[model samples]
Target: MINFPDDIFSEPADVDPDTLANLGPLTRLAGVWEGRKGVDLNPKADGPEQRDYLERIEMQPIDPQANGPQLFYGLHYHVHIVASDEDTTFHDQVGYWLWEPATGLIMQTLAIPRGQVALASGRASPDGSGLLVRADRGGPGYGICSTDFLEWAFRTDSYELDLRFNADGGWSYVSTTMLQVRGRDEPFRHVDKNTLTKVAEPRPNPSARIAAGKATLAQAHGFTTIGGGAGKGD
Candidate 1:
C-alpha cells in the first residue's frame, strides 16, 4: 500500500521536463509503428472465430504530469486496426501509458469506442526487456468498466497485456481478455497478438522543447502566435 503524506497538497519540486528520459521501460514504445500479420481470436455463436489484421500505433511523449506529491512521465497513444481483407476499421483505441520513476510503477489507461475502459498496472525496471500489466472486473483501482448494454451482453472480466522488446529494435505484444458472454455457461478468452516495426520517430514533448529553447512558451502550450493572434492545436 502507498503511504500517504500529511501534506497532501504539496507538489514535488525539481520535476524533470524531459518526459522521454524518465519513461524507463516505456521509452522504446514512443514512436509510430506498423504491424502486419497480426492475429485475433474472439468468441462467436458457434465457437471461436479467428482473423488476420493490420495495425498502426502512434505513441508520443506527453509533458510530465503531477498530482500533488506524485509525479508521472507518460505517453499518449492511439491504436488503429483493420482486417487484412477490408478497409473499414476493425478496432480503435486511445490511451496513456504512465510510469513513476520513484516507485518503478507502470500503468496503462485505455478506452474503446464500444463503451469500455480500463486501467491496468504493473512494475518493471528501467532496462527491462519484457513487461506485463493487468486489470480486473471491478475495483477502486486497476479495473475495468463497461456500459449497461455491454455489461449485459458481453461482460469483460479481466485483461492482460504482455510485451517484449526484440533484439532487432522492434517490439511484440500479446493481449488477452476474459469475457463472460450472455447465455453461455463457460467464459471465453479473446486474444490478439502482433509484432510491430517502427515507422517513424516521436517528436519531443512540449516541455522538452521548451527546456531546450526550441520553442517559445506560447508555442509549447500548443499555441501559434500569428501576427499577435493565437491558434491552438487542431
Candidate 2:
C-alpha cells in the first residue's frame, strides 16, 4: 500500500494558496503546452531508430502538500506523444513535478504506457534555470519498475531528464535513458529532446474554485469561518 500520514486533516500554518505560490520554478509550467519537433531515439530489432514526434505536456498547480515541517508545491502533469507520420500514440506519461521549498528538492514520478514507472529526484535552487533529475534500477528510494516481459527482454538501468528554460517564454528538455537489451554487449543510450511553446493557459485548482463557492454561500448565509492552509493527514 502507498504509505501516507494518518492525520492529514489537521490544520497547518500555511494553507493551499500559500502552497500554490511557493512551488518555486514549477509555477511557470502550470499550463498547457505543445511541441511538434520532439526527436526520439530508441532501440529496434535491427538497430537504433531515430524518429521525430509531436509532444503535448500539461502541468497544473496543486495545493501545497505537507508532512509536518516538510512542504511541497508542484504540478500534476500528463505528457502525450505521437509520431509525425502516424496518429497512434508513440508514447504517453503521467507524473508529478514536485518541489520542496525548504530543501530545494525536485522530484518527478513517471508512469509510461509501456508498463513501467519510476521516481526520479534531485536538488535545485530557485535562482538556477536548469534542472536534472534521475532514477536508477533496483533502488528502493528513487527507482524504476518494469513488467516481467520488459524486464527480461529490455531492462532499463537509469533515466534522466534535463530541463532548460529559455529566455523567450519557452522550455526545452533532453531525456537520456540507459537500457540493457538482451543479447547486447553493453548498455544502450536512448536519447530524446524537445522544445515546447505555450499554446494555452492553465486553470485554477478545483478546490480553490470550490472554496470560492463556499465563501459565496457562507457570505449569503452570513457565516464566517477561518480555516485556510494545507491539511496534515491522509
Candidate 3:
C-alpha cells in the first residue's frame, strides 16, 4: 500500500516547470510515430481473425500535475489505427502516460470511444529501456471499466501492455486483452503488436515553453502552477 503523508493539503514546494526533463522512462515516448506493419488478432463469431494495420501515434508533453504532495510529469497521447485493406479507422485511443519520479511509479490512463476506459499501473527504472503496465476488471486503483453493453457482449477481464525501446531509434509494444465473449466458455486473448518509427518531435509543455520565453501566457491558457507558485493564469 502507498503511504500517505499527514499533510495532504500541502503541495510540494519546489516543482520544476520542465516536464520533458522529468518524465523518466516516458521521455523516449514523447513524439509522433507511425507504424505500417502492425498486427491485430481478435475473436470472431467463427473463431478468430487476424489483420494487418497502419497506426499513427502522437505523444506530446503536458504541464506538470500534482495531487497535493504528489507530483507527476506526463504526456498526452493519441493513437489512430487503420487496417491495411481499408480506409476506415480500426481503432482510436487517447490517454495520459504519467511518471512519478520520487517513487518510479508509471501509469497509463486510457479511453476508447467504444465505451471503455482503464487505468494501468507499473514501475520502471528512470533510464530503463522497457516498460510494462497492467489492469484488471475489478480493482480499487488500477482497473478497467466498460459500458453495460460491452459487459454483456465482450467483457474485458484484463489488459496488459509491454513496451521496448530499440537501439535503432524506434520503439515497439505488444498489448494483450483478455475478453469474455458472449458464448465462449473460456477467455480469449486479443492481442496487438507494432513497431513505430518516430516521425516528429514533441513540443515542450506549456509552462516549460513559457518559462523559456518561447510562448506567452495567451498561448498557455489552460496551464496552472503546480507547486508553490502564483494562482492559475497569474
Candidate that scores best on lDDT: 3
> What is the per-residue lDDT of model 2 for residues 1-234, given as tens digits with 9 covering 90 to 100?
555457666646836653355667676677899998999999998999999999999987776677775677788999999999899999999989999866678999999988999999986545678788999998889999999998998999999999888888888999999999999998899999999999887755544544656334334333456672333211
Off by over 4 Å in 3: 125-127, 222-234
Please report the candidate that would top TM-score against the real structure.
1
Ranking by lDDT: 3, 1, 2
lDDT of 3 at 162: 93
Every model's TM-score: 0.94, 0.83, 0.93
lDDT of 1 by residue, 28-108 (tens): 999999999899999988999999999999999999998888889999999999999998999999999999877888999
Report how far off residue 174 is in candidate 1 (Å): 0.6
| C-alpha positional error of residue 208 in candidate 3 after TM-score superposition, expressed in Å | 0.4
Clashing pairs in 1: none
Query: Is candidate 1 or 3 superior in lDDT?
Result: 3
User: Candidate 3 lDDT, tens digit per residue, 1-234?
Assistant: 779899988888878999999998899999999999999999999899999999999999998999999899999999999999999999999999999988888999999999999999997744688999999999988999999999999999999999999999899999999999998899999999999999999988888978988667755655446662434342
Ranking by TM-score: 1, 3, 2
Which runs in model 2 stand beyond 4 Å of their true positions? 1-11, 16-19, 125-127, 210-234
